[model samples]
Target: MEWDIAKKDFKRYLLLERNLSNHSIDAYLNDVQKLEAYCSFKKTALAQVDARFIQQFLVFINDFSISAFTQARLLSGLRTFFAFLQIEYDRKDNPTELVESPRLNRKIPTVLNIEEIDALIAAIDLSTLEGMRNKTILEVLYGCGLRVSELVTLKVSNLYLDVEFVKVEGKGSKERLIPIGHHAIKYLKIYLEEVRPHVPVQMGHEDVVFLNRRGKQLTRVMVFLIIKDLAKKIGLTKPISPHTFRHSFASHLVEGGADLRAVQDMLGHESITTTEIYTHIDKDYLQSVITQYHPRS
Candidate 1:
């Protein structure tokens, strides 16, 4: 088979046969595509390519203004692609086995302090209809620490108010039960009972948990807009987005002594290592810790 044919089969296997999640498959394919693009940039094709070509691809990617993390992931993707070729294509040898990911220094995510989160939440007026929707959006986003896609795709049917939990279909269609705080649950109930009913329902989006006035599913862009506007109204100087709330959620939990593994499970992280960055400490917090615990203090 041609190189493209085998590549296509590998993608299908990752998706249908292996039941890999779309996000995972996308990462792998994007890596392969980046390699292809790098080659095209140099006027070469995959069939004639080998390890030296991949090393060059890595160096080329590094030369750009990219993070070590991004470069490392790209290297991983290319490595997997070549390995797949060796096994499925019956190649002579695996060419990418020696490739190394760039070394990375872990950085903690920025988060809104509890007071700041409270201020942001307080800034929302419960009296207005838009206020109601925005309030519910904020609660659920931070309360569950969900990615924007998961939050927007949340449905009315997944809500289990009696159990104080909501079902979320996370990365790879993996389902997790996230506890909904009573405060958030109260607002969500308000949105469901009072607000969602008034919005004009778009045909297929009837089940969507968050909707625009048109009752269509809230786009990622809309969620971003909501967060930006809310932050602006509250005069929050830090960069905030729908995802920021998730980071804040995880950070706050970690700071409160929630176990990292437990937070990972709630966040639907496949690996604990991926969730460990939430434990990153800021300079101010470190100073406070030193003063509180040191006998010299």
Candidate 2:
């Protein structure tokens, strides 16, 4: 099969069968395209490629000094692609099946303490309309443990404030209901009732929860910039982004003895292993306490 045909079929499978998000589909397609380019350089056909060719492609990418994490992600995408070809085209073998992914060290995410979170919120100038809206944004981010994409696309219709839950569309378009905190509900009500109505609602953005001054839905970059500005305002030296709030939300819950499965559900993680990283954070915190306060030196 031609590379282009294989890629098109793979994309269709990802969308129709796997239900992956557009961002994820694009990443998978990009990985296949990279392999296609490498094959073109080596005068190889997609149908003729084998496990040895796949290993050679890995060597080529590794020569560029890409990080092991990125290499592993690329290999994962290729594995999915070849598996698709194997199922649909009745291929005799999948080249990526024999290839092993690069070993990676999982990095622990940075988290904000309760005092720092409070200070970040306090640093907002609530006298202005934008300040109130920004405050609500931060509250929902920390309170809901939402991804930046989820936060930006949040809709007014999905917020069940009376029941204290917000419906979130996570990866693969899977929806989950996250319990909203009272503080988030309070600020969200203020923003929706007092601040949002005052702004001119754009035609298509009427249902959007957060808006820019121009009456359009807020972008992911806008949320990141807001968090960066807040971190700077509070003089926080830790490099933080919108994801820091999510990490803090999960880590704090785990430290407070919240169940792992419950935290996993709230965070919309498909696997408990992904959520278990917060337990490591909790252990690190305990180790710090022991190192600092324990008298048995």
What is the TM-score of each predicted model, taking all chains together? 0.88, 0.93
Superposed model 1: Cα runs more than 4 Å off: 18-27, 34-49, 61-67, 292-297
* Tens-place lDDT digits, model 2, residues 1-297: 787788888999999999999999999999999999999999999899999999999999999999999999999998888888889999888888888889888899999899999999999999988999999999999999999989988999999999999998999999999999999999999999999998998899999999999899999998899889988887899999999999999998998899999999999998999999988646666889999999993
Q: Candidate 1, overall lDDT? A: 0.84
RMSD of each: 2.6, 2.0
How many pairs of residues in model 2 come into backbone collision?
0
Off by over 4 Å in 2: 282-295
The prediction achieving the highest TM-score against the true structure is 2
Give each model's whole-structure lDDT: 0.84, 0.92
